[model samples]
Target: MRKMPLRELAERAGASPSFVSQLERGRTSASIGMLRRIAGALGLTVADLFTEENEVGHRVLPRAHRPELPTGPGARKYLVSQRPLRNVEVYVGEFDPGASTGDEPYAHGDSQEIFVVLGGRVTLWLGDQDEARSYELAAGDSIEYRTSVPHRVANAAEEPAEVMWIIAPPTPD
Candidate 1:
């Protein structure tokens, strides 16, 4: 391993020294691009930062260890990955019957979102308030939409709906 100082590493990554230091201390966040640059400077990949090296860098995340993401009574979600993924986020959501993410559609920043209905059923609405369309989703069904256009998810079935949502850039608008 190399013993490079923060300033040197930051310079190599084309990032500010303070920014790199803050990132290392977990006091701030960095975009995927910046993280990639830093990783490249260190002769590593972005995934390397999140690798759980129990058996030589396996990224596997067991159910018990997945972090829970707080939500309203409508849904219960678990962040299905360890922290520090600058590029993407994966969440498993258990939505109760008649529950929804919200009554209205919302848009995040320009990013792509994909949803998979793992169990039960759900109604996915895509588009803004002025113009929108809803699609029915059954178990094993999947859909992708532009988050920038605004969207919402709801469980209209009698049973709970389980879904896996993957978003790029890791930002929810």
Candidate 2:
């Protein structure tokens, strides 16, 4: 993987080094707006950041080959691609009942996110300005919203909740 220093990347993106550091280390989560700014500063599209580099042909990510990142104790995320690295990102996330991706609110630059409920229910918290929104999703329920403000998702059902999330420019941190 080609990685850049946090300080240099932050300076290039016109963001704080600490913020960039947090993002790189996955210590902080970013909103859609922040993601756009960082992507633009880095001369990339939202999808580019999420895709893997390929020299000749397209790569197919099998279920077993997908990168399952640990979001929390009871949460897991499978990233969908490895190319473009900027404009868009697709992920399948699963959260056990009472599990959370993060305790703090997540904010980033300009972008949008689409969440398709595959199973169970989840409570979506849209920053400190709005009240939590709860939705029970089966196989078809979906929601789309801007990612400029801080937000989070938690499983509210007794069983595990599965969601497919598509974010522009990918999420920071």
Candidate 3:
């Protein structure tokens, strides 16, 4: 859909192009980590890969049908937006104590993003080490930032935390 070459996608996802080719051909299965990396590289949430093209007529999405997005250890996310993706995409995220997106921050495409803390507290780390800024957000707090900025989100409290992620203009593809 993005007209991205397999090699390029593989390079971004940190996998061999041949492996990506095999996976695309249904000759191989991708681990959760690989799937997450591929989705990120393509400027998409992992669950976007499961959206069926023929679901245009549906008006309601049942909980049983929601796609679970693959995330890092101790963290889980679910796709909350309908597909054939429009101007925005949403995800509901749950993080256990000390859970985080990763140890390192990452950046995506040019889209903008909003992160809302629905429960507990979370720390939002923005930029690289030298210029990093950290915001401790409690329930009901939210932060908006560019998706292209290297950032990471982590659970700041010992208890579980819930968050909502919203991104605009859905990446290119």
Which candidate leads the pack in TM-score?
A: 3
Q: Write the per-residue lDDT of candidate 1 for residues 96-144, one digit (tens) a residue.
A: 9998888888787556789999999999999886788999999999999
Where is model 2 poorest over a 10-residue stretch in terms of lDDT?
Answer: 127-136
Q: Determine the C-alpha RMSD for candidate 2 after optimal superposition of all C-alphas.
A: 9.8
lDDT of 3 at 96: 99
lDDT for each residue of candidate 3 in 12-79, tens digit (9 for 90 to 100): 89999999999999999999999999988776678887777634565687877878977899999888
Task: In angstroms, give how far residue 168 of model 3 lies from its true place.
Answer: 0.7
lDDT of 2 by residue, 1-173 (tens): 22456785787677899998888788998888888877766645677666655552767888888878778789999988654544677889889989977876666655688888788887777656355554455657887778776678788678988889888755454
TM-score of each: 0.64, 0.62, 0.66
lDDT of 1: 0.80
Give Cα distance to truth, residue 53, candidate 1, Å: 11
Candidate 3: stretches off by over 4 Å: 1-58
lDDT of each: 0.80, 0.73, 0.85
How accurate locally is residue 163 in candidate 2, as Cα lDDT from 0 to 100? 86
Find the number of clashing residue pairs for candidate 2: 32
Candidates 2 and 3: which is better by lDDT?
Answer: 3
lDDT of 3: 0.85
